[model samples]
Target: MNSQAIADRCEQADVELIRLLYVGNDGVVRGHAVEQDHVPDALESGVPLPELVQSFNALGHRVKDAQFDAVGEVRLLPDCSSFRVLDHEDRVAAVLCSLRDSESGHPWSADPRSALSRQLADLADEGLEAALALESEFHLVTDGEEPSPHGDQGVYSTASMRNGHDVILDVVDALQAQGINVHKYYPEYAAGKHEIVTKYGRGIGAVDDYVFLRETVAAVAESHGLGTTFLPYPFDGATNGCHVHLSLWDGDNRFAPSDGDRALSPMGRHFVGGILAHVPALLALTSPTVNSYARLRPQAGAAAYGCWGVENREAAVRIPTAAPGERDTATRVEYRPADNTANPYLSVLGLLAAGLDGIRNEIDPGPPLEADPANCDEATLTDRDIDRLPTTLGEALDALADDDVLRSALGEELTESYLTVKRSEWDAFTDSAATWERERLRDTF
Candidate 1:
């Protein structure tokens, strides 16, 4: 941004500059940018948010203008002024910033970036570090008004290379320009939906990257003249989902080792086991939407059965069979049950707690799923072992209510507020009639 242009923006918006950072994750400031903690100049200007939102979106949806509202919930930190923006060697591109009230500013806890930063800071104090990334799955919805040319439905098909290239390319371009390490984004089995795989990062940085990436992808898609919906299931579609890929470490070494010939390390196995056992509780955070349950059906790839496998993408966690050193950074568990609706910070935090619990208890994860793991019978599940992720958000909530371990991890206040918000969401969803069921059962019932 040029000096004149920025001045004009401030003049127009009525806010003064406090701090701006060119964030890599959202290709903008950050999607989780809350209304709290804006710069003094920005607050002073009292920029008409509607106008400022355009400039913010131009950075990308992920990188949005901080919503500074008197009526909103939290605030920001006391600070110096710096307008965070992306720039070349000498020029600016994306910008992330903050504001203040002259009084003590409120910090936005709802901002996933802020929350993750807190978690990372806590871990750092303990001399531990985290390495994380995301495998975001979003459905492609062309106009429900008129059908667009659909793409190949090949599951990981080489044929999909033929369609949706433009949308994928533009999204990738925007993300890369913002410094997001977009490893690859390709078409999924569903027509409009796709996945973006990226290099992982240490500490809170990885989830921060996720927050930005998702916001950027949505923002850029809208710029390209289409709607981008991360709602786990756009319209009760065939396969609606999003999954997060993650790993843990103190620094250079990936944690734990495998006890036998199976591909999972002991740390990895225990981690997967802990997550699987904690499914009912974890899903409440991981897949926090009512539509989310609609996606986690028996046949779809939403991963209803809580299990892991060596190289089985169908299972919740897939250990890719690629050569050890070939994609070493990608050596992590692919958690498939999560959807886009869940706050990435809380979702990832749940995983961290489960994995850490496994580590602390020396939990031994026995045997790998040799076949399509989800198809396994009750044979492996003695009443003690038949644990599974919640079939619905309501069920997950029930589990969450009972689990003090998980509740304490998220803090009493946050957990209560979050669950309360989700409960109302669930109730509203159940009350609303859907075209599918309305046509299918309204008349019959």
Candidate 2:
């Protein structure tokens, strides 16, 4: 593009940031990103401004291949998620980009986006592919609570979306304005709760859409005097979650487990079996929060046990069980454990690792517990020998620690770092007297 055209685009980005300064979430402010859950912290303490520039230049050199172009305009390209450092209007500063492999199709370890990309490449190695999708769930909170309650809406329905329809519409517009495609959206079970189902996505792009969606939704919601949260079980008994749906394939063939059926054939069942076998461990990535336990209970609609079957939501892994080819065309398994809480990078990596382990070992996933495993007697579970998933984040972490196959997926450094962070979080929780414990034990003691 010519010099004048480039000048105009940079001016447009400055104009957008200025407007956002006026309407963007107050937390985002004019020069800082809202420090929310797990937002990356920069700790270059006490360094001089000149030294910081050298350090920043070194940071850019880490991933020298996926070059960014934000000097003259808002760099919103396929490989880069727009980075607008309000502090540096003329040049690039802070960013969250889609990392691509410089050498092969595999993802780079330094770039979190590549974690899922590598997994997808691994799937292709087995002559199979994964079609990945995600669900978005969060609450809408106002500055006040009771006297001025939020919107009235039912689960999987609409009313709240209509009452707060303007913000919802703006959210869609903003995302589309940036070329992201969100499918259907509606009210969730709780008041002011909502969910978004995006158009089919695959690999790093799938996760790219996810992070961008959450970041964008919050941005738009702020403009409407509403706050959006992807927190699972933001309230006790809310049971809200972000479940990932997946299906396998061998080139054009969709994979599922059906006897005598070459399609979704035995290989497919074994893959599902592998998913089931490592499921107890998979929960560490899927449901990675202390509050995650609240949603795993049978009443919460998240299948509490590790099992898979045709058309059973109660199963941790469930197949669509639709018509012939329907299972292929729309064939998929619903992994109902994840929430927005887990880092998208690690969660997808853990999932691909476990599934690949299943494929490699040729593991046989015992018979399906077509019935509600929860209702089954202890003898029934043991007779079937169905082991329940870890009941707490601590337990899940321990499970991941033991599963070497899982750890190898994220490499040692990333794995160790993740555990260190989570272990610290667990310690902090144990040290505090939570609301539940305070209410239950305070008066009694």
Candidate 3:
């Protein structure tokens, strides 16, 4: 959206609050609500937000080694291109912001959004561009703090979609109104769970759209007296994830697949190879939550192994089948390892960095698995060549700490800050006996 268009919309809608939004390291959307009268100036000069917003943990507390104190502040410069008039509000609009240093007037290194922008810029410098489509899986339930399922319909059943039709429709409509391209909506494997796939878009725009989509989904669901959870495993035996499909382009030439032998182009293979090599470390950003690990177990459909395949859902990276009559449609990779707990900006940045490293080094992605190795018996995977990803958040973090390339790509500030926060979470989880432990251990003893 243009500035004039945003101004016009605000005037027409009588928008009273202009929200300056940012996604924190914790993968939550945090924002400041500004009165409409001050929005013009705020848009020009940017909203003043504490730097600690980026330094804080999931619970909104500062990490132990946070660089900024309470007094440090950053400017949230609104990206007018992403402005939206929210559906749940009577007179409110929102725009995603990029954090900028107040003193130096530079992009803050700690900002995840900027980190993504930097990677995209680097890709641009290499005469390449990336497109991404995010398919977010979420579960809708009746209202409460810990809501119950809205219905017990079989996974992907029409009944599941019917049960949450009103809420889902509202979310889809609102997102469409905000210029989000909603592609498909359908029931997912988990009860009361649904998946929505948006149209593919370029680089940062795709990530920005996802952030808007998630916030819109949550807000619209709440307005309908329904609750939704993107938690990787909010319920036992149920899994939710944000499966990302990616492709690279140099002008109009697609790099994902070549006309020659093998499904992917040499560059695309290297990209896949890079992702496989760094996936263990990538999980620290792509599947950051403790609950995320619970969903990454073997044979659970979510890929536990660092491998790619042709339409094999069990592979960490799956090359989706191309639609008939569309020559370039098959030239994309579905990275199945990510979940909603990941900060989208960081996740994209990490993947892009890894892929770029692969291209630069011309890394070869070994053979694509022809079968679902996660579902296969132990011997099958061993013979076919598959490696498991980190099965725990602590283990993933340890892998991230050891990956010097990934750490350098993310920059030291973000790496250290993220580690501190995640380590704290791991410590908290290990210190206490969770409900699962009590349920399994109490009777066993």
Indicate the worst ten consecutive residues by lDDT in candidate 3. Answer: 252-261
Against the true structure, what is every candidate's RMSD? 7.4, 9.1, 2.3
The Cα RMSD of model 3 versus the native structure comes to 2.3
User: Per-residue lDDT of 1-445 in model 3, one digit per residue for the tens?
Assistant: 6666777789898898988989888888888888877778888788788877766776666776666557788899898888888866678899999999998888888888888888899889888888898889888878767677777558778887788888889888888988889998898887888888899998898999999888888888878878888999988889899998888887663654556446787888899899988999999999998899999987788888989988888889988766654536547878999999889998888888888888889887788888777566778767765778988889999999999889988899878878877787776678675766888899889
What order do candidates take by lDDT, descending?
3, 2, 1
Best by lDDT: 3
Query: After aligning candidate 3 to the native by TM-score, how far in Å is the CA of 399 from where it should be?
Result: 1.1
In model 3, the runs with Cα more than 4 Å from the true position are: 1-5, 375-385, 434-445
- Which candidate, 1 or 3, has the higher TM-score? 3
- Report the C-alpha lDDT of model 1 over 337-384, residue by residue, as the tens digit: 887766676788888887777766766655655555456667764533
lDDT of candidate 1 at residue 125, scale 0 to 100: 79
Candidate 1: stretches off by over 4 Å = 1-73, 76-114, 144-152, 156-159, 235-237, 256-262, 326-330, 433-445
How many clashing residue pairs appear in each of the predictions shown? 45, 2, 0
TM-score of 3: 0.94
Can you write out model 2's per-residue Cα lDDT over 292-363, one digit (the tens) per residue?
A: 777787746787888777767787877666575465467666778787777666666777778777767887
lDDT score of residue 355 within candidate 2: 71
lDDT of each: 0.58, 0.59, 0.84
TM-score of each: 0.75, 0.75, 0.94
